[model samples]
Target: MKYLSLIIMILMSPSCSISKKNASVVKEKLIVTFSKGKCLGNCPVYDLYIYNNGRVVYNGIDNVKKKGVYETLIALDTVKRIEYLMKHFSPEEIGNTNGRDIPFTILKINDKKVVYRSTRSSGNLLKINNLIENIKDKL
Candidate 1:
């Protein structure tokens, strides 16, 4: 029994040390921001910020369900999924078109940034819109 206990402790020590080492590696903060412009008709204009800690802030400017600043906490899993999506996003995946009246989406992933403006609606914009709605629903 003594030998068995010693062997178990020895096996557990390495994993504990490994986990501590991994925990020491600081992860970069993830932030997602979305903003929209006014259109020809009544369009909601808002600026939203989502942090890795699951804190979200939405500033509604005009024609929105809620006006002024509102803050809420989202699920950590949702934040992780958003981080994954932003990290994998590519500028080449979305094309730009001339549309002055349409809303523009500015997505920033860490230090990288992309502005999306489409005359004819695209899948990327739809994805972003859906993300915005999801975040709002949580709030």
Candidate 2:
């Protein structure tokens, strides 16, 4: 009976799945991915990703000042602000809102997402996009 109890206690203890050496290799969860499509004129076309580790990855496709893939890092707090913005002011937009001359973008988080073609977004959603823009400038 004592042996059984000891074994149970050992198994229930916090299992150290991430060791110290391997800790650095474990990346935070992917929080968001934004993809922008081109328009009739010079509009930036790219894809951006944000991870909880404050890592940002940007892939500029065409018609943008920056071209090619670039990776940059930001503060964890900024990433958290992004999380808050996403939760508090998620856009209800479901379809393309602007004409063909304007660009469209898809912003995804977890299982939910919103797509819009409007030149701008509403509320804190615009802040989220602004944050992404700042991330890209760092790259």
Candidate 1 lDDT for residue 127: 65
TM-score of 1: 0.67
Give the poorly placed runs of model 2, Cα more than 4 Å off.
Answer: 1-26, 90-96
lDDT values for all models: 0.72, 0.79
Stretches of candidate 1 exceeding 4 Å from the true structure:
1-30, 118-128
Per-residue lDDT of model 1, residues 5-123, tens digit only: 99998887768677787875444244888777678888778888877777789998999888899999888887777667666656565675566677766666578676776344345
On the 0 to 100 scale, the lDDT of residue 3 in model 1 is 100
What lDDT tens digits, residue by residue, belong to model 2 across residues 22-52? Answer: 6766656788999988888888899999888
Predictions: Cα RMSD each: 9.3, 5.7
Instruction: Look at candidate 2 and tell me the lDDT of residue 92.
Output: 59
How does residue 113 of candidate 1 score in lDDT? 72
User: What's model 1's lDDT at 100?
Assistant: 62
